[model samples]
Target chain A: MNYKTVLTVCPYCGCGCGMYLPVLDGQLGQPIPDKTHPLSEGRLCIKGWAASEHVVSPDRLTQPLVRTGDDLKQATWDEALDLVASRLMTLRDRHGPDSLAFLCSAKCTNEENYLLQKFARTTVGTNNVDHCARL
Target chain B: MNLPQEVLTEETRQIVSRLLRDNQVVGVIGLRTEHNHTGPHLFTSADDLKELTLEPRYPLATICQAILSSLSQGKLGVIVRGCDERALIEMAKLTNIEMERLVLIGLSCSEELARQCRCRRPYPSHIDVGEIVEGVSPLEDTQVRRLLEQNVEERLAFWQQEFARCIKCYGCRNICPVCICTECVLKEECWVERGQIPPELQFHLIRAYHIADKCVGCGACVAACPMEIPMTTFYTLVQEKLRELFDYEPGLDTKQKSPITTTLEETPLREL
Candidate 1:
């Protein structure tokens, strides 16, 4: 019988609403907006209310896959990364760095996105870096 | 769309009986079928078990208030949905119902019904007897979003055209679980003015503001509105914005308090 609430900040946006993750048997119960928190004042939007749904979602991806003969086949981490690097390098050589673009994710930490942008600029030689959050 | 009437399982019946047998709730409030038409009704000790129908259609919150007001002393148990829970939670905040005395038996809505309601969370978090399932997050309304993208004048004009269909039946207020005041501000001659068609945009604005923190997104207001104004979409947007700004979801937890009741200093913006 696991029962505990971990106070964590909502990562959807910069608002950083305070909420509690109710842990039950290693599975997370729905988020309860922290009433004592400074920002939310005990009200959550649809995203905040349903924040926990994604964590346990069966559709959530767990492994890397590459398109192989119309079907995506699971690939080892090194193979996947090597394929990506080789493709990116080929594209940059063929179409120039200005033609290549990179998209970041809200799911990743800010430092991760910063590193991705740095890799795009210094390694890939492209300035066209952006984030899905911009949408 | 008509609700699924035949889906009531035997487990639900037993649960209802067990609840009534155990607690002295004023009554179990839910929809019932009588004279071949279904509507909200209260189930009492004397009422036949056969009369308890969970399907067809019902304004559950309205029936709940009636039960609460008529018999103020006894604790009441309600079979609530996500929206009903939100309304009840907001009502609890306003002191409309005694929280300690009340017991809530939540019933989760199905995915198909949830999608129709554009509900982000279709089920209540704390349920006495029901299987928990994942709910779908609804897509934002295109019409409302398009209207919002327009300038102030266009938006005002659009609302003016929509509100013009109002018959002033007060069905929206009468059916709302959150609009619990005996004397409503919208009815006052000073605030809303008498003999006004559409009740002015300000009237709607005031109504929206009054329930800003409390609107449970039950769509009861929309369902009750004979005029069929897209009130749910508006309320949903406002509710979403509130959650975005504050990160609060209503009715899931009884111990939690709304941000509106507290001073801003106590609940500062997270980014700030």
Candidate 2:
């Protein structure tokens, strides 16, 4: 009997369209545009409307996986991060910093993206910084 | 029929309050005004009646479907306008809603709102509170008339230019109350190629034909579209054609099967 809409921002892109996710009996429902939102003005792109699909999708990843031979096996966060750091260092040492490229996502926050580019430029010493939203 | 807006609102509130007090329904689903904003709300008690405000409309029928599906027992009340009531009837026909376990509180639309939507029927079957205003014919709209006047080539060119701005946003389909398919053909790569912006014209044509017998003229698709494509005008034309060909108008009677979905025996084609 409990039904309410939770006003939140769309997680798909940087447009930050305001949307309302209907919650019925603690389950997330479809997304609807927030009419009162000054920026979006009651309009949403395709991604914004389907933003809640991944939250309940069965294919969504919940844990990190490390590739071994051909298959990927579940691993702890500590193990995954250590593996990434070591592989990155080895690649940097073997190849020039210019060979390394950093690709950021619109799903990440501004601060997270900034830190990623900073790490690429300062720590790895690479100018190959790219973003998914560059298009 | 010429009552002031405030008087209608007050009358609606009193009726809802009475329904809540008498336990006619466990809850009344309507729009609740809060902080100068309004959204769909489920009023469980009479105390919340003061916040009930009806002005800017939302797809209340969709919310009603959500609530009714999840509700295990007891009947639920919903405030429905013409479009909402029509949508509910269509949903019931499709077995998406249990019409028996629900009560409809009809609310008539204002003439201005009716004209804005270009709705053919602005009021529900029965008006509980608000005045019943005249329905606006879709042909009265200049855009619809102009589009109708265009030849086949001109119409194709016009739609091509308009659909070019489409971002492939499914807002129109998502907001439609009668579009209750769990697996949509629009998402299929076979029907519509993946990663193609401004999807093939078949994308729009498929959707148009699918909902031809079910469209309730809610104008939600037009409002939800980011590109502001004149979808209502296009659907209204389809509706007009259906009327002329079969004398079939959807959402008017739940028992009457859509001419497209039925066999010749069930719903015979009208003489041209």
Candidate 3:
């Protein structure tokens, strides 16, 4: 008896097609193309139809995990970030900054990616940074 | 293709019963014999077993979605053809149906039915009951390419004439295996423009462009279309173009993501 469509932009690519995530009974239904959007104008490829999936996907990682003794155990944010920083510093010290490479993710927010690149270049002092979307 | 009166083999029946008993699935959605015409139906209770039929008409997708939506979180079994399998995959991508909870009982269409549907692969790679056979080659429809070869003006005129018959029943969108949007743009007043003849050139163009890579070439749109519009040709062209550009095929591998979504590094086809 309850249904609503929440408008949002697709995150799959830089195309940024506008879409509506239909929520019925508090469950996500499907992505509805935004007829009025300028970029796509009510058109979506297969990815747009599936844009709402990652929001509530079962496969989505809810928390960060750190590998320990051949197994991954969930760790608090502070613990995980500290561990990452220490290991990265140790690698940078021994193997030099160029030894570490940064791989950009499509899943990260634009701001987050910018911050990551900034951290990699200014903090880590390495130009060995590449994007997953070079294609 | 002539549909059988009743086509469920004993093994299929047993599997269906076992799934219903074993899994928390509420029912099995498949064809049913009603008034001598097979149509899609949902069989939840065991007593409704006699009503299950897998012949003539195939409406498993519609029936399964309806049943799944009506019920709370639970499982359901569905009879799937190549088209149904593709529809289910696309639906799962859109979150319209949960693929994990749902059980698939694949059924290969008869060679004649496969031919009639212009099916590329009439059988599922994995099957539970039906015998596997190579799919009939899709009949060639050169009309779209022929239109493409025309000048823009001629192409416009041709499509104008073709789309003129569209009553805007949204049948093509409704029957499309990949068109899962609850609110379609074709129905919107601004995009398609309500109560217009020869619906603006953008109508068909936009819809075709939208489903270009996603279309599985099911021909359901053409079949549901009362106007007999050659939608398959457009989708086939789109499919071919997608393969050429991205080297991706829909529904063949459920594990692999669509090339469009994957990054260049992750996409094997992009290396080419």
Clashing pairs for predicted structure model 1, backbone only: A38-B267, A38-B268, A40-B246, A41-B259, A43-B248, A44-B243, A44-B248, A44-B249, A45-B243
Question: What C-alpha lDDT, on a 0 to 100 scale, does residue B154 get in candidate 3?
Answer: 88
Ranking of all candidate structures by their DockQ, best first? 2, 3, 1
Q: Candidate 1's residue-wise lDDT over B22-62, tens digit each?
A: 76665676655455434444555544557666553344554
Interface RMSD of each: 17.3, 1.3, 12.9
Interface RMSD of 1: 17.3
Q: Is candidate 1 or candidate 2 better by DockQ?
A: 2
lDDT per residue (tens digit) for residues B16-67 in model 2: 8988889999899887776655667788888878989887788878888899
B126-208, model 3: which lDDT tens digit per residue? 68766766675443435655765789798667767888877665656755667767677876788978667667778888788
Residue B75, candidate 2: C-alpha displacement in angstroms:
1.1
DockQ of 1: 0.01
Index of the highest-lDDT prediction: 2
Task: Give residue B16's error in model 1 in angstroms.
Answer: 1.3
Candidate 1 C-alpha error for residue B49, in Å = 1.8
Error of 1 at B250 (Å): 3.2
Q: Choose 1 or 2, whichever is better by TM-score.
A: 2
